[model samples]
Every structure is written in C-alpha cells, then in structure tokens.
Target: MFKLITELKWSPDGCRVETIPKGEHEDLPERAVEIAIQLSILDQSTGGPNTGQQPEQPEQPEQPEQPEQPEQPEQPEQPEQPEQPEQPEQPEQPEQPSKKVKK
Candidate 1:
C-alpha cells in the first residue's frame, strides 16, 4: 500500500502559505509553495468590497398620442338633356293641257 500526507504552513504575517509533505520527510518544491501562497492571497481579497451594491438603471421618456381627423361628404349628380321640335310639310302645283289642229 502507498501512503501520502499533506501539510500546510502559514507565514507569520498571514500573507503566504507553504505546503509540506510529512510522511517520508521530503521537502516540497519551491514552485508549489509559491503557487499556494498566491492562491491564498487571491481568496482573501475577493468578494468583500463589492457586497450588496447594485448598478444604476437608466430612465426612459413616455411618448404622446396624436388625434385623428374627420372625413368629408360626397357631391350631388348632374341634370338630363331636353327633346327636339317637329318640321312643317310643303303643297304641290297643278299641270296644264296641250291643244290639237284640224286637217
């Protein structure tokens, strides 16, 4: 069976953290310790300064309604045309007779 142990150590000023392996007494690498310290600082600094604050909302203006106009009435129709007058009749003249001579 394999065994693993993890240990955490904090600096005196509370600004840094160091991670150590304790089972076989092996020293942790410098890069791992530095990363742990940076993560600790970030966790401590977040979420306290901006608590309970809301962003401001912009105000919008209301629009006015326009009134509608009334429609006009239609025009009257035109009158029809009148009928024409009848023409007068003319009289005819009599014909004259021809005379004959004796032999």
Candidate 2:
C-alpha cells in the first residue's frame, strides 16, 4: 500500500481508463507503482533520486534585531571665507599735452 504524492492517469489494458488522485492507494498494481517511482511522484521517505526542487522552508518567525547604525560623523562646519581686501584708488593719468588751436 503505497501513497501517490501526485496525480496519476493511465489506461490499463488499452481499455479501462483510470485516474488515481494523490493519496494512499491500497490496490495500485505493481506496474502502476513502478511508474509512480520512475516519475518521482511516489511518497517515499528517501525521496529516492528526486531531481525536482523541494519547497523552501519558511524563515524564522522572529526576525533578528538589526544593530542601530552609528550616526554619521557630524560634518565639520565649513570655515567662513575671509572677506577680500578693498582695492586702492588708481591715480589720475597726467593731462595730455594741450593741442595748440590753429586759428
């Protein structure tokens, strides 16, 4: 009496069609059991040579507390830029030689 972990469908003797739902089957034929084993759909404790991936186990219910991140080092305040010195006034250019008016 093996358990079919997955659905099975077949037509025995090319006449009687059968569909076995997943559950314990008390009267499954030897050939049907062999097919189930070959298909890796039988409920075997060893899960013998299964290639399909199993469902992942759920994560723990309680999440671990995350450590508080250290506060970023306070950015140093930028120094105030020094005021530029005022420029000295330029001396007036000497007057050009007065041009003699040709009357």
Candidate 3:
C-alpha cells in the first residue's frame, strides 16, 4: 500500500504542512502548516487522486500438499547356455618303398 500526499498552505495565521509521495509537488515546507482544514479535506476526499499506486488485489495464496511414493520390484531372468560337441577326422599315413643294393 503506497499513496500519500499531504500538502497545505496559508501560513501567517496558521497552516503550512507537507507530506508528499504520491506524484510529489514539493515546494519545501510551509514551516508549521496544519491548523486542521477538515483534515486536509479528508485527505482529498479519500483515495483515487493519489495516483501514486497501491490498489490491485485479486487473489493469490494456495499451495501445500505433496507426499506419496512407494512401489518398485521387478528384475529376474537369465539362464541359457549349453551346446558344443563335434570332432572326428584323422587318416593319412602310407609311404614306404625304396630298396637298392647292387654295386
């Protein structure tokens, strides 16, 4: 919430305040301003003229709820290896014929 503007002038007999913030006008202070002028006209007829900002509520606030986790179990399958037997091939031996004795 932001919006303020308290200005008044008339010094000499009494009155010369200043608050500033909304829009700002500045001239320095009036010295002691404030003898009560309907509370500065009820702060300028309440809201709207501030123009300094502050006023836009719609709706926001809601988020809290999270807790749930439990489920995990599945892994088992491995077994297959058995097949090897083949060996038969051996036959090659025949070479002997050489005789010569005559001198």
Candidate 4:
C-alpha cells in the first residue's frame, strides 16, 4: 500500500488549496475547512468527500458550567447595632439644714 500525504495552505485569495500527489485529492484538515468557509471556498459539495466532518469533534462533554459558584449567598449584610444610651447624671445632694440650734 502506498502512503499518501498532502500539505494545506491558505491561498492569497483565501482558498483552502492543497499540495498533493498527481491524482490524490481527498483528505484535508477541519481547520482548512473552517478557513475555507470564512473565505467562501467551501460549500455543500467541497469538503464532504475531501475533508469529511472532523470525526464529530468528540462532543466537548458540556462542563456543567461550574455550578455558578453558588453565588456565595452574598455574605448577608451584617445588621447595624443599635446605639447605647448615655448614662444619666447623678443629682447633687442638698446641704444639710444648718446644724441644729446649739444646746
């Protein structure tokens, strides 16, 4: 069996052009297909037989979105404490009446 190979490159006009053996044309990279799509070089008839579908891309497993980190519950704002009342001033005692009359 002969081993076939090809090299791909972007043409100045943005086509997915390739270098291959005289009669071999099938087989290309998905990256090539993507570039070609952007450059308008690919359509329904272009990549299917040559590039195929890239082995279905392996599905990427979805990653579950990291569960959103549970939002941390916002840490619940601390309630403000009530102000303490100032202590009342003590009343001064009245001076005792003049000493009882002298004996």
The C-alpha lDDT values of all candidates are: 0.39, 0.70, 0.38, 0.47
Question: What residue runs in model 1 are displaced by over 4 Å at the alpha carbon?
Answer: 1-26, 41-103
Clashes (backbone N, CA, C under 3 Å), per candidate, total 0, 0, 2, 0
lDDT of 4 by residue, 4-32 (tens): 32333544345655542422345545555
lDDT of 3: 0.38
The superposed Cα distance between candidate 4 and the true structure at residue 64, in angstroms, equals: 18
Write down the worst ten-residue block by lDDT for model 3.
Answer: 28-37
Q: What's the candidate order when arranged by decreasing lDDT?
A: 2, 4, 1, 3
Expressed as tens digits, the lDDT of each residue in 1-103 for candidate 1 is 1112344454534587654443332233434334433444212222332224332332233467667666667667656544654456556555555455666
lDDT of 3 by residue, 19-72 (tens): 444432322232221222224422333333333443244224346767666666
Model 3 TM: 0.15
The C-alpha stretches of model 3 lying farther than 4 A from their native spots are: 4-60, 75-103
lDDT computed for candidate 4: 0.47
Candidate maximizing lDDT: 2
Q: Residue 69: error of model 2 in Å?
A: 84
**Winning model by TM-score:** 2
